[model samples]
Target: MKRREFFKKGTTAAVAAGVIPLVTASCVGAKDMVYDRKQDKWFDLGTGKTGSNSRKKTVAYDVAVIGGGAAGICAAVAAARNGSKTVLIQDRPVLGGNASSEMRVHLNGVNNIKGKAERETGIIEEILLHNRFENEQESFPVWDHVLYDFVVREPNLTLMLNTQAIEAVMDGDKIKSALCWQATTEILFTINAPVYIDCSGDGLLAATSGAEYRTGREGKAEFNEKFAPDEPDGWQMGATLLMSSKDMGKPMKYSPPSYAIKYTHEGGHKRRKFAGFHEGIWWIEVGSDDDIIADFEENRHKLMGYLHGVWDYIKNSGKFPEAENLALDWVGSLPGRRESRRFIGDYIVSEKDMTEHKHFDDAVAFGGWSLDEHNPGGIENISEPPSYFHYHFEEVYQFPFRSLYSKNVSNLMFAGRNVSQTHIALSSSRIMGTCALMGQAVGTAAAICNKKNVLPREVGQKYIKNLQEQMLRDDAFIPKRPANDPNDLARKASLIFGSTTSSGDAKKLINGFSRDIDGKNNHWQSDGLSADLQLEWESSISLSYVELKCDTNLQRNIMMRKDSRNDELYFNGIPNELLKSLSLEARVNGKWIKLGVIEENRTRLIKFKFDTIKTTAVRIKMTETYGAENVKLFEVRCYA
Candidate 1:
């Protein structure tokens, strides 16, 4: 059957899942793969509505994402939106990984670079912006639901919470199916897919599939890391237990739980200042010098004791009067872990790769978080700073595709903290925000892998440019790698100009960097709203889609913080620079006809889809902004 007919005649065939050979699953990740086409076809096979039926479940998707953290969410969302039938599996009831309410480690990214922020753009940015609108209160619990809503809203995505992808059913070097355990439903699910992404920080599936991975600290000579221990050791960064205290508006009595380990702070490091005591203490952590994941429970208990111990010091200790009224409001039982298994990829991203800013032709993502290697012994070693702020980046560094997939496992790709990198390199890339971008990259690549019927490594070796082009069109910024999508009709225009040139020329819109960086502007700014931008072609061209990348001040952070900080560096509210009201019209022959209008725009990458039109010129009129007096735009693209 023709592939188009495979989608059209969906109701005719039974979904005889694991054995059907998956005819149409070869499609690259595109949003139109599977859907309501067979919604009315499922026959009611249940006998007594709640009878003892088979607990084994079988489903299929083009891409299967293991883990529902920031990285996993972005990966699943990207694959689904790009047209792949995608599944996101999370072992926990809630999403957000370390940033989840249960853990609440802040989702930090390229927060600062030499006194300015060059924030990430793409799915991760969309997520943060969504949080700003839906979670202005910055409540961590509400943020979880906000993320759940975001994932469920995607028409092509399926989410399974409290489900863990425990094992990989391997076929030679590729993973044929994932044996997942849905804890809540008590069902063992067999998820079949062409591509599998292990964004799970621990990479359980990758490990079980025999993907090459390494744990523990690397010697400085291995990756030429300057900050590495003299020789390789089993020491891994610890998991942290966090707690929040709220001021009761009056003095409250203090008492220590029996499990509390006494904290005297007699020999504490000088840098361990309780700067934001009311929110939580980050250094209240514990690490394992050996078998970190194996020591989770032991570390959890110790971390809990240490948490209350520190709280006892703040509340009962006479050193500070301000914390006398502060009482514990929330405490995390699950520790947010750092450093477990570093899956080996074709290339291992080392410390110098980031600090030296090495460029990769197969670069798919960028990260600028500092080399924040936490101290070896955690809070137990109070004499040391919680982390050694090894080095900072003045500019963002490229993350290569070769370092995102397994060197041994053919079909397995990874994102999040588990992707192939040295311990020192992970210090910067492990930040949830940075991990989110990597998720989007791999997610998009997974769709491409399905479309091309190739492994992740092939996607890197041959089709890397295609992957980069797609990411760019979707609003991901690859520093120095300007987008050159061949299908972008705006680039072919004979003339392009804005109604008013204020900061950058309209011609710069096709130059391809989506955000201003390194003191160079890649966007066009209007003197005021209601400005007009036009593109003209020498002859009539056929087109149906128009995409625009607008300004959201990437130089400032929009991530939700514990303090809900809204300063110049960290912004808690929606960006005022977004173009709120815009209309698109195309010139047919000599007259102009309206195409579409967006009144309540929410995304930085604005898109318009309509019937194809033969036009010699197109005009976009911007009427208003969220708040800014002037409207700014980065790029404009059109496709048929």
Candidate 2:
């Protein structure tokens, strides 16, 4: 008999007899099939290979995070750091999903607000700082590795790479266990976790587990999102495989594959000069809305052809006279998918929430980008009113904590681009910075749930508040105002300084601290002097330190600084080292002179004592030891 016929007959008989036959070079061997007692059935056909009817050991965990993308890493780290025995399962070898080194897409967000990095913090900030240290300019691969290391290094996190979750064990509506197949070992491993997080952008876990989800655009009436189409549309933002090129001496010959030319520029729709070329770094996106999974193979081939075609066009064509030396530098191994399955969460954030700047009671993350819906054809579609437009709000809009948890599955949480949101809302929130913040928030929430021994929904408003506070404390921006406290006040002061400080003294201060001050629209200079000499400190020791004094006891809060940008204090074009040596002192004219010295290592601030200093002027003078030629005060004010 032929090999195919023999194997087919043998497999059919063995399966019918409740056994699996292993084929070997010499002979075929059969083993009895063991049913999963928990699943109450025999293994289903077409499941991934897991060896010959042998059961594998199972490990129990507190939390299981599916997918190792930006959100998954954050969730695993958060769960592990909070004392949960967590396991992170990723099908790919590398951690970053879309933003991986393989993909090589630039991390984009609202980072260019007023020319300053805005609302970017937490793990994302750590990664950027790491990038800054490793390379003067950032690289995506380095960033991807940083995320991978962060997950694998966590003591409580068990990172299982090259493992795909093929089956889920469900009890009623809850997930009891998940079965993953390891391609290398050909073994099926099971992991039991109390809580599960779907960080997979494709919503694979949710889909396989029978969790409710949505796809494509929703009708405007459903959520009242103005940008949403009047009628429900099947349109979704497309996917792309990006490529890069550098200048080479001569032009290279290139041709696209037959499948790549499926759709061409037609109906007088002119193609851009670099449309088919890959010479330019920025001009590297291609794919289609027809079915991401079905067309993925063909799309990849087309991308390669287009990339080479781009290089050829640049070098051979006369468009770029200076690009005689350009050549293909890099191309992505995997395509970056923009839209997929969106898991249904407790609350779906809508575009109306963004337009109205809707404040949620449980706001845990904020996003500021406008709705930037891409065209169905993978190329940016330009319309009359334009498919993308900015909202009326200048401030970032808040996303609630409830939206991060699933509504159908009690113990499941989600993050990243797959979080509960309409397509319009996702256009703004899908940015990496916002996704990182969402990851940080979800991680914090997962930790809380694990520690408290409660369902995600039962985690409560108080716990959400605590999580938000912790996120803000870690530098992740939430929509709510941070609590007003001495530490917060000091941090604000340090931010105002924009330079490193030691102890209580603002020592080693650089000149023109004013230039470093951020968030200041107007250019303001400092006038270093006491309004009245009588109000100054009595001793030269007190004069050694520079202090911010306030008058009229204003009811508003005051943020004083030597300069707007950094903590550099200068006197007569000379760097003043005295600001670090002396402590801050405060007094309300002869009434037990509160006389508190500036803390040894931090910015100096004396909250106005309204009871005694009402209608009085407060003075901040240096200690007597430091004498400066001319001391300038950057900013002085009192707030109620």
How many residue pairs clash per model? 6, 50
Q: Name model 1 segments beyond 4 Å from true.
A: 1-51
Root-mean-square deviation (CA) per prediction: 9.6, 12.9
Error of 1 at 393 (Å): 1.0
lDDT of each: 0.87, 0.56
**lDDT tens per residue, model 2, 35-132:** 23243345547885434455565889988888887677777777787678889988888887876777755555553333333435456645543443
State every prediction's TM-score relative to the real structure.
Answer: 0.92, 0.66
Q: Report how far off residue 580 is in candidate 1 (Å).
A: 0.7
Q: Candidate 2, which segments miss by more than 4 Å at Cα? A: 1-57, 114-116, 137-139, 249-291, 301-318, 321-323, 380-393, 460-462, 484-640
- The digit string of per-residue lDDT tens for model 1 on 1-640 reads 4323322333222111111121122232322213112233434466433324355689999999999999999999989988899999999999999999999998999999989898889998898889888987889999999999999999999999998887677799889998787778767788999999999998877876777777778998898889999898877899988888888999998798999999999889998889998888889888877667667888999998998888888888888898878888988899999888788999999999998899899998999999999999999899999999999888999999998999988999999999889888989999998899899999999999989989899999899999999999988888789999888999999999999978988989999888888888788999976899999999899999999999999888998889888888988899999789999999998999999999988899999999999999999999999899999999999998
